[model samples]
Target: MTGTGALARMQAAFASAVTDGDEAAVTAHLAGDPALARRRLAIYREAIGANRRGALRSAFPVVARLVGEAFFDEAARRLAAVAPPACADLNRYGDGFPAFLSTYPHAEAMRWLADVARLEWAWHEALSAADATGIDFAALAAVPAEEQPALRFSLHPSVRLVRSAWPVLAIWEANQPGRDGTPDRDEGADDVLAWREDGRVRMALLAPPDAAFVEAIGRGTPLEVAAGSEGWDFAPMLVRLAAHGLLAGFAGPQSAG
Candidate 1:
């Protein structure tokens, strides 16, 4: 095998040994005395496991805190075993964790835990999302009145909308470092808007109509349809989103031509 091929093979073997407890696959790659090599490989396995667990813990600190260290650690271990990282970047490793938690048998009692995890993941993504420039209001204004309704606006890359039956936003806020207290009402639904602004991740609770409007726009709906029923004032919501840097840009009907 070429050097690159050998390296790839070794990496695959090491991953299988660490993640599956199958040391035989990687045994041939180790040098030195057989016994010492096995012992060192064991150490390496433990370190790799710890790093995976650490990545999970870092991504889902609120979940870890809520479930306690022992429970969270085991869950993390299970997740790593089932859904090993596809890429080397551990920061992007736990996108499926929220779905896993929702179906996790031990987590059934805390029904809201999964939604809270989703919120945290959104916050994490927003923090890491690429920076974007705001929309050109002058360009937007130049569109003729008849063509305005066909315009489709784009949200900032960091914008994420999360709607959950539980009070996820309140739960997330309450679990923040040094914060204390439970949500005032846990049963009510919440429409959360998460996005990055000025290099900080920010989350806000949106009213039902506002959430629907934003969701529609996010789906690439034309301005006319996203505006919903006639006589309902959507101008304020547009202004608010634009003011917050959530509006990235817009494409008119002719742009698709």
Candidate 2:
């Protein structure tokens, strides 16, 4: 094999040994006494597992706290075994964890756990998302009244909407540091909006209509259509979003005209 190919093969062998415990395939590449080489490889395997657990713990602290260290560690190990990290960046390693938790046999009783995990992941993503320039109010004011309804607004890149049948937001808030672990109520649905502002991740509980409106806006829906439902005024919501710097920009027929 060429040098590059040889290096790739070695790396693959090492990965299999450390991640899967299939040491026989990599035994030939060992550099010292056979037993000592095996021991060193064992240490590497343990270290890698610890790293995976640490990453998951960081991404899902609430989950860890809820399940306790033993349960969380075991779940983390199982997740790593089933779906190893696809990239070198450990920060992104737990993207699949919420889905994994949803179907996790041991977590079956805590049906709401998956939704909570989803919210936590959104917070993590919002924190990691790129910063965006706030809406240009001067330009927004310049749009003709007739064309305003057709405008499509952009949400900040960090904005995330999560709707769940469980009281996920309340549960999450209750679990925050220095708070009692009891949520105000535990049976109702929740609509959560997560975003980053001033280098901090912020979350809010949205009413159903407002959540729908924000979801529509995030999907690039036009203003008129997004607010088309009768008996609801989206003005306050709009003002609130603007105040929070959630509106990134806007474009529509006016821009083309």
Candidate 3:
């Protein structure tokens, strides 16, 4: 076991070795004293588990409020056991948690748990998205017609657009720190537009068309000139993006209306 195979075996051992009750196989392979190897393995397991748990906790603070502390911890622990972290970057952990919660036994009762998880993940992603020097409205308004064609547009890194069938925003707001409100899904579901500008996460409800507009930009659409997307209102889209600082400068595409 001294060649590449040995290295492969060593890697496999780490996952297997980290289990709380198993150590005999891995300890025999290690060069160190058996007792020392077992203890070290235990330490690694605890540290990794703790780090993963903390990341999950941070990603789902709102969910934690909806469910009490003890329940949240138990669910997090179970989720860790079910879906181990795929990347070492703890900041982006729980990216797949939304799908996981969709089937998680304890969370099955809450059909909206998955939606909340998705919203939380989006919030986390928005916080780390590339930053922009907010949309320069003055410059945009000043551009001349001929120069506009060549003008390119880009978005602030913080802009993230999310659309869900669930009344996600209302539910999230209902569980907010100072919210004295009620959950009224029947009122309407919402499209949530979020951006991390001014060093904080800011979110608002978007009309269908406005959401489509931002999504178009996100999918690499140049500042959309035309409006009336599907059945959504363009005014809401314009107003919301302008307000949240999602507008990055738009460059002129090859041609426009």
Candidate 4:
């Protein structure tokens, strides 16, 4: 083999061995001693694997707390084995964790755990999202009534909605530090409205109608269409959204009046 081709092949083999735990492939490429090479590979694997699992633990501390450390660590290892980090940025590595937990055999009895993970991920994203200057509400109100229906509203960059059949918000709140009292297991379905305000991520439980309104707007629906969505009443929900400063801006035809 040419020098360049041999080097490329060795690099690929090394990567596959490191990530896939293929000791035999790596041992074949050892320079001096096979035992030394195995020891080095073992150390590398232990350190890198722990680092990756640590990132997941940090991102999903509540999950760790819920499932306990030993069990959570086992799940994290399994996740890393199947879905190794595709990006250099570890912060973005665990997006599939919630889905993984949902299908995990041990977690099937705790269906709500996955939703809680989703909420934590959303909150994490909101914390890192860009800031937005709120909309000019006075100008929005001043727009001609006839043109209002066509207006397209934009939510704040930090705004995120999490809809689940489980009472995720209540469960999350109950698990918070210093929180007392048991969470009601039968609290029913909930939709969470999350946003960053004053440099902190905050969340509120949305009513079904309000959840539909926000979901419609998030899909780029026109104001009139979102307002007229089934089970939605535009006025109070609009007031609540404005109060939360979620209306980042709007665009539409210029008012003739």
Candidate 5:
């Protein structure tokens, strides 16, 4: 193999050993006493496992705290083993964790934990999304009333919607800094709206109508069609969206529908 090819092969073998705990390729590739190589590889594997656990702990602090550190660490390690990092960026590493927790046998007792994980992930994503300018409502108002129905409004990239059958917003807020009271453990469904504001991530519980409106707008649905949806009421939702700087811009009739 050429030098680049040889390096790629070695890297692949190292990844296999570290991620899967398979030592055969590593044992053959390393130049050292067989026993020493195995021991050193074991050390590297342990370090990687620890790193994955730490990454998860940071990403899902509430989840870790709720489960207790020891159990969280073990769960993180097992999750990492199954869903090894696909990229070098750790920020994107825990996308599968929420789903994994839903089916995780040990987490069966804490059914709401997975929903909490989803809320945390949304917050994390919103924090990293790009900044956006506020909507041009003046221009929107200038459009002909008859044509306004075809206008398409854009959502800020930082906005995220997370729906759950648990009171995820209450659970998340209770875990925030300087919080004292326990969450209600309310079984009613909730839809959380998360976005970046003033360079910090903020989350709020959205009523069903508002959630439906925001979700439709985010998907580029036309104003008329979106407003006609089951739970939509244009005026109030528009005011809320504008106040929070959620609307990015709009495409008028000729530009959109």
Candidate 6:
């Protein structure tokens, strides 16, 4: 390999050893100065450790509470080793964790964990996407009747919808502080729409079709198509969006047919 290729190979080996538990390859890659190699690799190991755990802990605080901090830390380590940060921004680190948990043997034992992680990740991402001011109703009202049919609305940055095949909202609620009453061990599913209000993520339960309709709109389906959706009442979808601060305002519009 040329100099650039050789350097690339060295870095790749270094990363693999630090996060992949390949001790033999790690030591070999270090070669002449084992101490220096070990020391240099240690920085990456420490960095991946801190960023993964911190990001996961921030997103899944309640799950951490249920599992306790020490156990959570150990689990976070395993998770980090298997799926370290790919994004430069550590804030985006836990995006894949829910899927990872679903496949992890231990996580299969606690089936609820995957969904909990999903909910947490949604909140984390929604809190970071670009922000928008509250609906500009005045500007919307100014649009002429003829132009109302071409408007499409954008959602607020902090608004997010999480759809799960588990009772994620109940699980989340049972673990919350003031709401930590009796726990429900029932098998159920729910959708949740979360958003930041006054700088905190607020979550509200959503019905299935309502969740589906919003998803359809996000997919660029027209308002009329989304609202008149077959087998689903679109009114409730509107209510949920209004309640969650998801609606920034109309963009282009169509007639209220």
Better of 2 and 4 by lDDT: 2
Model 4 TM: 0.88
* Model 3 vs. true fold: TM: 0.77
lDDT of 4 by residue, 214-252 (tens): 988877788888887465467897878889888898887
lDDT of 2 by residue, 1-257 (tens): 59999989989999999999999888998888999999999999999999999999999989998899999999999999899999899999999999999999999999999999999999999999999889999989998899989999999999999999999998998889998779988778999999999999999999999999999989888999999588999988889899999999999774643
| Minimal lDDT window, size 10, model 4 | 179-188
Candidate 6 per-residue C-alpha lDDT over 68-116 given as tens digits, one digit per residue, 9 for 90 to 100: 8887788888778777778878888877778877887865667878888
**Which parts of model 1 are misplaced by more than 4 Å?**
1-7
Which residue segments of model 2 deviate by more than 4 Å? 254-257
lDDT of 4: 0.84
Local accuracy by lDDT, each model: 0.89, 0.93, 0.74, 0.84, 0.86, 0.74
For model 2, what is the alpha-carbon lDDT of residue 251?
A: 93
Q: Model 5's lDDT to the true fold?
A: 0.86
- Which candidate leads the pack in lDDT? 2
Summing lDDT over every window of 10 consecutive residues in candidate 5, give the lowest-scoring window.
Answer: 228-237
- lDDT for residue 64 in candidate 2, whole number 0-100: 90
lDDT of 1 by residue, 31-74 (tens): 88978988887888789889988988898888888889999989
Give the clash count for each candidate: 0, 0, 12, 0, 0, 8
Which stretches in model 6 have alpha-carbon errors above 4 Å? 1-13, 21-47, 68-75, 142-151, 177-187, 229-244, 253-257
Instruction: Give the least accurate 10-residue stretch of model 2, judged by summed lDDT.
Output: 248-257
Give the TM-scores of the predictions, in the order they appear. Answer: 0.93, 0.95, 0.77, 0.88, 0.92, 0.75
Give the higher-TM-score candidate: 3 or 4: 4
Give the candidate order by descending lDDT: 2, 1, 5, 4, 6, 3
